[model samples]
Target: MSGVSGFDIFWLIFMIMMMQPILRQKFLEAARQRMIRKLEQKRKSRVILLVHRQETMSLLGFPIMRFIDVNDSEQVIRAIHMTDPDVPIDIILHTPGGLVLASLQIAKALKRHKAKTTAFVPHYAMSGGTLIALAADEIVMDEHAVLGPVDPQVGQFPAASLVKVRQTKPLDKIDDETLILADVAEKALNQMEYNLEELLNGRFPEEKVKELAKLLSQGRWTHDYPITFDEAKALGLPVSNNMPEEIYELMSLFPQPMRQQPSVEFAPSPRRTPPRGNGKSLI
Candidate 1:
């Protein structure tokens, strides 16, 4: 301090103070990059999560979990483009289902990718969700996990359900509106079969592929029917029952349905005498 000039010491202090925030930001950035690299190495692929559940928000003090659509084709396409084209990708899917067109867009993108793709279902993926899973080269699921029938839904109801109703009802009872719905349902089923066949072409033999498409598109099974790993394998799909251990760990991040808390009240403590004996009895 005696040897250094006053201006030199002040300048040194100023520089140190100025660098603090910059150093912190750099350190944080480096740590994030390291974590990403570690995750990629352990997972053996670039991982994406498609977790879908009813999300709610307050509207004038009323909470409602409205059905927000999941037509995220643009976002998915961007993610696909951003991912390394050479490496495999693992998509963790947990959706009940969504629009057919949206799901088809994602499926086509996955199919077009040069590298291998796998879908991991820790719980369930149904309807359109099943369609995307089918597009993957392989599917991994837990013993209890399920993939549901891929039959297209018309408006709010399953198209196959409409067709079934029309068939079972008496001719006199079936009205013009019913006839129209049945016709639309038939066309919807046909379009689904065609799309599925095109997707399954390179993966399976022509005959087997058509059979599988028929099974998926037709109303043979109910929309909510669960297709477990064994059933899926029996249907000639490339499925593996052995899900990765890390997948379970990843599932912990997803939100679960909230259970109603029990109505509990704490009892007030009873009044009690401090002691039985005293130094002197009251007169």
Candidate 2:
């Protein structure tokens, strides 16, 4: 049968059409697996993500609650302990920040680990997220990646905003309750600055460490302001714009949040709070 009969030709065409979707799906699955494997190989570590997606579960178009909270600190620590101490770690961080102490805990682990640690920010790492990145020996970012102000947020307001009340407003005009908050804000900012300095001290000079702590925790910019790779490098962070190609592919696996803005209803307190659950919080 050098040439297929008419019936044979029809069957071949039908078979191709039927197999297209199955073949496409298999191809995608294989591609995804390959991407993950490549990412692991390139980084030379098991990749872990600590990300917070901004959108929250809403009711009638208004965010009624937040789902992501729990810091996977314990889990992360376990993973690190299980790994050979000499092996490098690459943490992919994309968070809006969380409990300060939880972030600090993870940061301390990374700082103490004998292996080189790198933080990869594909989109954004903010607040406590910034704290974790600070602990890493190096920060890898894409041109579009963002790291934000790490100033602690108290209740519904930024600690800096509360502190500003004391700096910019006349003392007499401020209420006793507002004054109390302002005082707490100042104390929080100072404590954050101190801790931040400690985290960066070994890697950076005294002056540079002070500068970063001030810029990140003292709120020179808005808490949500996005500091790109160039801006981060200028600020004396160990930032490299060069990123692995697999990072983008990996990030693509996580879909963007449905909401454009973070839910304002559930404000994380200044103190360290446990994560909501295993639920994801990603940029």
Candidate 3:
């Protein structure tokens, strides 16, 4: 009674270890279902809600809820099938970017589908997301919404990316860690070059693709520079700049799976044994 007992402490730790998965799964499943329901609810228009956030999933334990999962394409396909094929898919994108191959696959699917594909960006769509948006017939954005460079990037440290351009001394002068990272960065940069070139081949004109890739890779924050609404339209993508408040609110009011009753909340992905971390969000 005077102090905490060992048994109680062990019990508490065990409970936490066990509960974390349950809670995470529960939350993600709920979110997925809620969003799915919202997506399906608009069957009248045949819209499939696609949300990919290019930001990191989590930083310091909390998920950034920005980034697209390649795996999500499978789920999205399933959702589309469940709806009437005639219904067009409306993708609401607000992502910075993600895996190049993953983004390419999503964009390819969008392009292939007979259903009309349209992208709406309440905020920003950069990189891979930009690629996907480009595939859409129409892009809807507000004045504040931004589209970023579709450049390729590899995760080299801030230093290595510019070393060759500014190497101050001989190799031996460089720190071991920096040297190692530089080697990795060199390889990564090469891969990025290949990746950007490959992705842009058919997606954009060859001349514009190469030029944009170079500018974008070295752009703001290492991935892309900001491209405003006008630039997006100039890219030959149809654009919609304003969404009236009433229509916007109607869109927002779609049933939230998280808020639904447990009985009808929707089935969690029981097919997944371990928890899938928040199934790629576009917050």
Candidate 4:
């Protein structure tokens, strides 16, 4: 047999390089499934994750933002349907929000589940993510995690602002397009408020439901305003700060697309304080 040529060696190296990413992805996926199984076994509940992150294309090296869409709603709803009615459900939400219609579909499906439903926010869940969180019977968040307002947006403008403009501006001064947008905005606002009320009705008192519905859907705050744990409690949401350690571990598995240099870094292990009166530090 002839000895391996230089060209053959180059081709072998090239093939291994190409296969590396595929093998890595498979390993990561297996690890995630194992984590999910462990969590389910520990909590005796079904686990569903609605995580959205920037996905980088391997060839183009461009990032694409993922969000809740019709496809996401379909898969989530299918998961809910496949689950037994008596089993509790835990939703791990991590998104900057997405389509209102898609979010509503997911919210309704989760609300219809017979057993208790919980939403866990390890970071921020804004806009439409907030809408889905509202449907859960309980919301569990990390101490520093945040939720956001669910105000409706029409195109690039807030529905509340559009409606305000139509009300304040003279009929002759307002353009036809502006008037049309205002009309649509009013309708969207009403629909959102109604749906929000419906989701919150049984969980809170009727008066409290109406108040929360109007407050969240009226665009009182900017779209991305972070509602901290204290604020959420003040607002009477059934939110708790007792987050599970497994949740943080699961989030680590869904790493953001790679970058040349990471923006933030810290020691991976937990820190412990030295014993009282001891001169030495504890590692």
* TM-scores for candidates 1 onward, in order: 0.72, 0.72, 0.54, 0.94
User: Per-residue lDDT for 1-283 in model 4, tens only?
Assistant: 9999999999999888777666766787899999999999999999999999875435444567898999999999999999999999999999999999999999999999999999999998999999999999999988899999999999999999999999998989999999999999999999999999989979999999999999999989999899998899999999999899999999998777787899989999999994586676566
For model 2, residues 112-161, the per-residue Cα lDDT tens digits are 88989999998888878888999999999888888888898778888999
Top TM-score: which candidate number?
A: 4
lDDT of 3 by residue, 87-171 (tens): 7777777666777677777776676666677777776778778777766767788777887765445354433354563366687
Kindly indicate the candidate among 2 and 3 with the higher lDDT: 2
Between the candidate structures 2 and 4, which one is better when assessed by TM-score?
A: 4
- Give me the runs in candidate 3 sitting further than 4 Å from their true place: 1-45, 52-66, 80-87, 96-101, 150-170, 186-204, 218-224, 234-238, 242-247, 250-283
Query: All candidates: CA RMSD in angstroms?
Result: 14.3, 15.5, 13.7, 2.0
Error of 1 at 81 (Å): 1.4
Query: What is the Cα-based TM-score of model 4?
Result: 0.94
Best by lDDT: 4
Q: Going through the candidates in order, what is the number of backbone clashes in each?
A: 0, 11, 7, 0
Q: How would the candidate models be sorted by lDDT, starting from the highest?
A: 4, 2, 1, 3
In order, the Cα lDDT scores of the candidates are: 0.78, 0.79, 0.61, 0.92
- Residue-level lDDT tens digits of model 1 in 1-283: 3698999999999887677545654664465456545557986677766767542222222223321144466677678898888888887788888778888888888888889998889899988778889999999988888998888777777788888888899868989987887889889999999999988889999999999999998878889899998899889888997787667655553334333773554564567787766687865
Instruction: Rate residue 223 of model 2 by lDDT.
Output: 80
Note the residue pairs that clash in candidate 4. Answer: none
User: Which wins on TM-score, candidate 2 or candidate 3?
Assistant: 2
Model 4 gets an lDDT of: 0.92
